[model samples]
Target: MTAVEETQQAEAEDFLVDKAKAVEVEVPDAPEEIGRSDYYTAKEVSMHNKPSDVWVSFLGNVYDLTSVVSSQSRELESDGSSLVFPLIKCAGTDISHWFDETTGDIKKYVDPIKNMMTYYIPQGRFVHVPPAEPVSDWDNSFEVPWWKDATLKVGKLSASTRSLRVKNVLTGHEHLMEVPCEETVGQIRARYLEYNAHAASYTWKALKPNEEKELVFQNLDMTLNLQDNGIADDQPTFEALGISSDFHTPVIHLYYDDDLTVA
Candidate 1:
C-alpha cells in the first residue's frame, strides 16, 4: 500500500479503538457542591487524532497529502500570508456523489481553533460533512471532504440571468429584484424583509440566516404553515419561517416563478 493509504488505515484503527473505549466508559454525574471534585468521577479527554487520519474513508480514496500541502500553502505564501500546519494537512481527493457536474475537490486541513471548524473552500465549491453542528468531546475532528468544496466549472446559471420577487404577507405589498444566481436564498429573503414595514415593526427580528433556510434549490416546492393566524403583517411570513427569520407576526405563503427558486 502507498504511504498515504498506510497512514489512513492506522488512523482508522485508532479511531475505532477510541470509539470502543468511549462506549465502555460511563460518565458520572457532577457532585452537588458544583466545584467539588471526586476521584471516582470520570474526566473527559480531548481525542488526539491527526486531522488527515480523521478523514479516512471520507472520499473513498487515500489522497497524497503532499499535493494538498504544496498547493494550499504555496497559494497562501504567494499572497504573502502565513499557512497554518493543521490547515495544510487536511488534504484529500474530491468525491461527491451528488451534483454530477462538480469536480476537482480541494481539502484544506484546519484545527479547531475555538471549538469550530472555520476554513474557506476554493470559490464555487461547498464543504461537506460534520453537518455544521456543535462538536462534543468524543466527536471526531476531521476536515470536511473535498466534494463538499467542489465548484462547478460550467453549465450553471449566472447571477445576471436570474430575478427574485418578494411579497409582504402583511400589507399585500410586493418587491421585484434582479439578483445573481450565486446569491444564497437567505440573502434574497433578508433584502425582501428589510424594507417590509411589518417585519421592522416586530419586537425582535432575526437578522441572520438559519439552517432551515439553507435548504437546496431543488426542494423549493415544499409548503410551510404559518402560526398566529393567517394575518401576514402581525407575524413573520412562511418564507421567514423556512429560513428561520426571527419575526413573531403571522406569515402567509408567497410564491416565486419556477426559475426563481429558493436556495
Candidate 2:
C-alpha cells in the first residue's frame, strides 16, 4: 500500500478509538439510594383495611393502626360508645381530609351552637377525640392523640406507582399488580399472597435481558426491586422515543417450590 494510504488508515483507526471512549464517558450508572426511606403504595395500605390489620395514610405518611384499632374497639364497646366504628369504617384509606394541613392536627371548626371551637367530625367522633360537652363519665386524662402518635407510622406514602405482571407457571394465571416504585420484591410477594395463598411456596423469577441481549427467566433477589436488579423502567425514554411504556412492562414468573406449605 502507498504511504499516504497507510497514514489515512491509521488516522481512521484513531478516530474510531476516540469515538468509543467518548460514548463510554457520556453514559453513567444510575446513582445508588443512600439511607433509603421505606415507602408504601396506597394499594398496599388498602390491603389491611380490616380492623385486625388496619392501615391508614394521612399527611403523606402511612400508619399501621391494627393494634390501636383492636384495643380501641374493645374500649369503646366496654364504654357502650360506638365512636370506634367510625375508625374501623375508614381503615385502609387516606384520612388527610380529617386533619388540618397547616397544624398537622385534627380539623376543628367554630361551633354555631356552642359559639366556640370544636372538632369538625362529620364522620362521627373516634378514639382520643373529646366529647363536645363535658360529661361526668368522660375520661379527662389520656395520652397523646392517635393522629399525633409516631409509633403507629410504618413508612412514608409512595409518590409514584408502577405496574408489574406476575405469572404463576403452576396455575397458568397472570395477574397485574400496581406497586410502589420503592418497594422490594419481598413486599410485592406479600401483595401477591392475597391472590394466591401459597405465594410463598413459589420461587420468584423475572424475565430480564441478559448480557447476550436476550430475555430469559433469571433468579431474582427478593430483597431488591426490579430496577435495583438491572431491570429498569425506562418509561420516560420509551415515551420520548415514541414507544409505548406498556409494551416494556417486566413480567415476574413464579415456579412452584413444592414445599407443600399452606397459607
- Give TM per candidate: 0.18, 0.56
**lDDT for each candidate structure:** 0.34, 0.80
Determine which window of 10 residues in candidate 1 has minimal summed lDDT. Answer: 37-46
Give the RMSD in angstroms, all C-alphas superposed, for model 1: 29.6
Give the C-alpha miss distance for residue 28 in model 2, angstroms.
Answer: 25
RMSD of each candidate relative to the true structure: 29.6, 14.3
> Which parts of model 1 are misplaced by more than 4 Å?
1-159, 197-263
lDDT of 1: 0.34
Best by lDDT: 2
* Model 1's TM-score against the true structure: 0.18
Best by TM-score: 2
Q: Which ten residues in a row have the lowest lDDT in candidate 2?
A: 27-36
* Tens digit of per-residue lDDT, candidate 2, span 196-238: 8777777789777899999888888878877897768777788
